[model samples]
Target: MSRWKPHVAINVRNLEQSVKFYQNLFGVEPVRVRRGYAKFDVELPPLNFALNEHPYSEVGALNHLGLQVSSTEEVLAAKRRLQEAGLATFDDMNTTCCYALQDKIWVTDPNGIRWEVFVVLDQEDDRVPDKQKILVEQPAVACCTACEKHSPLANE
Candidate 1:
């Protein structure tokens, strides 16, 4: 890839509901609408995101998406916008999440996809919620020595 813009194609259960939720959250109208899809070309950055209606499945609820803000103020502003839209907002102020110093708001869209708007303060060495600790505390492997030998890769 030649370092171009980023685009995300998400599967949604209801196109109308997802479009409305995204429009309210981003404070913008959909740039394009199709039979089973809606596209929002947010002008602030190079994010080209779209949602399409598809058959729902429990195995694939979230296909991964995130928003990285420039500053903490932006994070708070996003939270306020989400709250004003009457969306569910989960805030963890000055908390470490995904191994980064972040303040963010969490909301699930109509398709059960988690959306995260976050401003990162700093980087850390571990995933927040500490999965490794849980794994170590309750070792499910047959050999603890082999388990310790398998070093996990870092999240890209």
Candidate 2:
């Protein structure tokens, strides 16, 4: 519990549906659940994932959410596991995304939020050397924005 874990709280249309989706995705039951809310303290990825039940119809222009893994094998493994769990997955192998070469798999939550488990193949990618400049020029969402739009689950 020493290292910082990323906390993501996304609004969902139905708490129960989201809870079931996450349970299959993370392979763990939410540590806490209540009316209009649910929380899964994912251990393997060290994420504080939460869902808020609301009448939130607009998903906003969120580019996506992701888990950065260490290798292509790991990415493939995730694809296999998720697919086996009856979740459809999309693969983007050796693509230059977020200005870096990466291998990743994409999945859409019941709420239409795109999630990716990716591995950066080229950390020193010269696409955007000035990290701060990239941040200033490109809308943060632009990084992987196209990735989600082109995903098979884009409509889902």
Candidate 3:
């Protein structure tokens, strides 16, 4: 069996300010920081959390939540289990999103909260030159049917 980490992603009005605040609160700097996103892999309370810069009016503070799996096999297995239980699942393979290349499968809980089982394939450097910023676009539509209809974050 692989380790499963609880993931929480939030929408922040300001990435830098939120990152600094969380660093102080958690007493550790983020392990990963990108242009508009940051991740804190905290061990004290056991959290795999991240923040993404977004206008508050578009989506409330909470973005989405997920489970970080160690391997693609785990993602597939989880997807299978969810599907077998009658939940709809959507898959995105080798997709570049959230500043990283990931393979993921998404599902929506009854309350319309989107959850994903994903494994990172590669992460882009945080300090990439400004010229490269223009080429980066917001991620395509998310993979959960319920979330897509109810949450603005699903299109981000």
Candidate 4:
């Protein structure tokens, strides 16, 4: 078993601009940069942070937060724990998302914040297509009924 790290994914208006900003803030360049995405594997603070370029009007600047586990088993264990606790979970196995092949589970907090538990299986050269990206982005609105029921914003 390996250590888990806090992962934050932010939606940016421009990839290049956001990348430069993060580079200055973190004082290190991104570990991976793709067509519409960039990742920073920061060690001092232990963060697996990423920037995703998207239309600001469609989705706000903040994307999703996550825990990057070392293995798929860890992800499944998290899914089971969440399910047992009566929380809704969405599982994506070997999905090519965010320019990586990953096994992940998504759970929304009572406040409607989405948390992803995932392990990277492999990396891909090309960026995720818009159609597929949309499906991944809207899991709360599209799948998580529990989130909607508890979300204050969902009502208004």
Candidate 5:
């Protein structure tokens, strides 16, 4: 049997800033990192969450939900099991998402929410993405236009 953990992906305006914020909030460092992406695996309550850099005008905070399995075999098994139950499964294999190579299967719920069962590949990618090159996106709505650095939410 394979272990399963909850996976949550959220969109953020700035990846570098958000990563720092989440690190302080969770008191843990992200296990995975790539250009504009970071994955935090928390052991306290057992959660696998990721932050993705995206435009605020694109969508809401939540990107999707999923179960993080141990291996590709488990992912394929989940795919078959899901399909056997008559749910349409979409395969996304050898894809570099959230900064890692992954094999995942997606299924949409009745409410149009998507869920995936995925496994991160052990293959190593040597090309490290330069963090300084990431472009920051602005908030969709006008916010904190005139706030001080330490008083409220502002550049510190």
Candidate 6:
């Protein structure tokens, strides 16, 4: 575990909803929860993420990005491990996020940034970032009502 692993933080529209979404997606419940912050000590595939509930209208651009795991069980196991570590964990069994079939967990650190640990079971090549057409969903959820609302991007 000496190798450094990158940790990312992002903002969420709703803490409770985001918490629930991650718990179900990753298959682990949060070990800690507060006003608008959550943390998960995710293991298995190895990811560090934090989630924060921000005013839907006040949210900003994504801070960083992430990669999905290979299995639903991996997501679930990660969730369980995180829960055991006394961190907040959320499991999304069969939900789609960021344009991929994912089982995931989410958390928010003290700084009010969001992070997600997920496994991609399937994908849709909708957003082509480069010459390689990899499946991807929109960057982040739209805060304004005028933005396109997708289930994965929406506040669960």
> Model 1 off-target regions past 4 Å?
1-3, 59-63, 124-156
**lDDT winner between candidates 1 and 4:** 1
Q: Clashing residue pairs, candidate 2?
A: none
RMSD, candidate 4, Å: 13.2
Per-candidate TM-score against the hidden true structure:
0.72, 0.80, 0.48, 0.45, 0.43, 0.42
* Model 6 lDDT tens row, 1-156: 796665645577778766765565445666678888887655633556677776555335654233367766766676776576566644455565556666666644323334455676777765556678664454465322111122233553
Q: Model 5, 24: alpha-carbon shift in Å?
A: 36
> Model 2: residues >4 Å from true position, as ranges?
125-142, 150-156
**Model 4 misplacement above 4 A:** 1-60, 124-156
Cα lDDT tens digits for candidate 3, 1-156:
277767877777778867765664444789999999999998855788888877655544445566677889978887777676566777877777776777887765433346667898777666878667544344666533323544435556
| Model 4: colliding residue pairs | none
The residue ranges of model 5 lying beyond 4 angstroms of the native Cα positions read: 1-60, 123-156
Error of 6 at 77 (Å): 1.9
| Residue-wise C-alpha lDDT for candidate 4, range 58-82, written one tens digit per residue | 3343345566889998788777766
Ranking, lDDT, top scorer first: 2, 1, 3, 4, 5, 6
Give the best candidate by lDDT: 2
lDDT against the true structure, each candidate = 0.69, 0.80, 0.68, 0.66, 0.63, 0.56
Ranking by TM-score: 2, 1, 3, 4, 5, 6
For candidate 3, give the lDDT of residue 106.
73
lDDT for predicted candidate 2 compared with the true structure: 0.80
Candidate 2 has its poorest 10 consecutive residues by lDDT at 132-141
